[model samples]
Target: MRIAIVNPNTTQSMTQAAAASAGSAARSDTVLIEVTASTGVASVESHVDEAWGALSVVTEIERCEASAERPDAYVVACFGDTGVSAAREAAAGPVVGMTEAALMTASLVAHRFAVITMPKRTLRQSEQVVRNLGLEHRCTVLAVDETVAELAEGSLHLLDLFTAEGRLALDAYDAEAIVLGCAGLADLVGPLQAALGVPVIEGVAAAVTIAEGLVAQSLTTSRALTWARSSSPSEAVSA
Candidate 1:
């Protein structure tokens, strides 16, 4: 199976990091195609950044669709799952979002999951994701000491901060699982999970795994409901 991994941020390093993690988790026969957004913020930090990054992600999806070797599934690498609905509509195959995959993966292993994210600005967006997934009762959103941009730059100090916050979520909030709330923090999943002694869901890896399942099952997002085409059939063709 072929899978397309779209990194919504403009930074190629972030795309590389996402690809590395996804590659490690994916099956040996699965072919992975990684694409970085050509235009957007270096890192998606706020809702506004997510909004702008979405357009770039959609563009990449279109490009993938028109490619000679199109993917059987698509994975939006952003923790926010930016542009996922749009991409699902445009593609013929399944599209998986990082946030949804992580939360779903967490739910299977633990009843209560807490997200450990960056600074304060992105907390509400993560909360919105929980609410959208109907996981508000099962999940909590928390932040670490670093900003989104800082983590993308590979800050060593923030790893400890994330571990500390993960501990708090486990001990204080009584969380049974932790979801890493930023794609930038994907590399720290193993260490954090080991230290906390609980399941740690990294969005990128989770999304890749979910995408693989959907592809194997020959399933894609249902266009008959939430993602139904907005334009008329004729209008869609004319455009």
Candidate 2:
């Protein structure tokens, strides 16, 4: 199966990070086409950015669908899941959002969850996403320490410091799961999960796995709105 992994921003580093995180989680036979948006905000830190960044993601999904090698499913590589619902309408496959995907994955293994985001802005966005997904009952907190951009371009020396903050949030909130709330933080899933003694999840990888399942099930975007209802007859007479 072919899966299109779209990093809905212009940053190459974020795209590279997302691809690396999704590597092992994808099906061995799956072909992942990593893509980046050409025109969009750099990173989504607020609702306005989240709303705006969506257009770029939808545009990329349209491009992917029109290609000969159409993706079976599409992974939107933004933690905020910008434009996911709209992309779902444009694509002939499932459109998985990182925020929804991570929460779903974490919920399967944990009773309570908390998102470890970057800075105050992202933390607020994360909370909004949780509420949007109606996961407030299952999620305990949305915590942030470092700015995701800083973490993306900054230092490996801060890993321990950041992870410790995440661990504390989990403990204090009685969270059984810790979601790394940046597509930029995708690389730290393995070590963090081990160290935290809980599922330390990355949105990028979680979205990929969910996309694979959607593909296997032959499920695509449902045309209930913009695409509208079918009006044409197939002309193949029913028996």
The number of the candidate with the highest lDDT is 1
Report the lDDT tens digits of candidate 2 across residue range 70-166: 8788888887677876777677778898889999888898988888776666666677788988989888655555655665553355578657877
Return the lDDT, model 2, position 104: 87
Q: Each model's TM-score?
A: 0.94, 0.87
Model 1 residue 156 CA deviation (Å) reads: 3.9
Q: How far is candidate 2 from the true structure (C-alpha RMSD, Å)?
A: 5.4
On TM-score, the leading prediction is: 1
Give Cα distance to truth, residue 80, candidate 2, Å: 1.5
Model 2 TM-score (2 dp): 0.87
Question: In model 1, what is the error at residue 172, expressed in angstroms?
Answer: 1.5
Q: Which tens-of-lDDT digit does each residue in 152-175 have in candidate 1? A: 666455778888888889888889
Candidate 2 regions exceeding 4 Å error are 151-155, 225-239
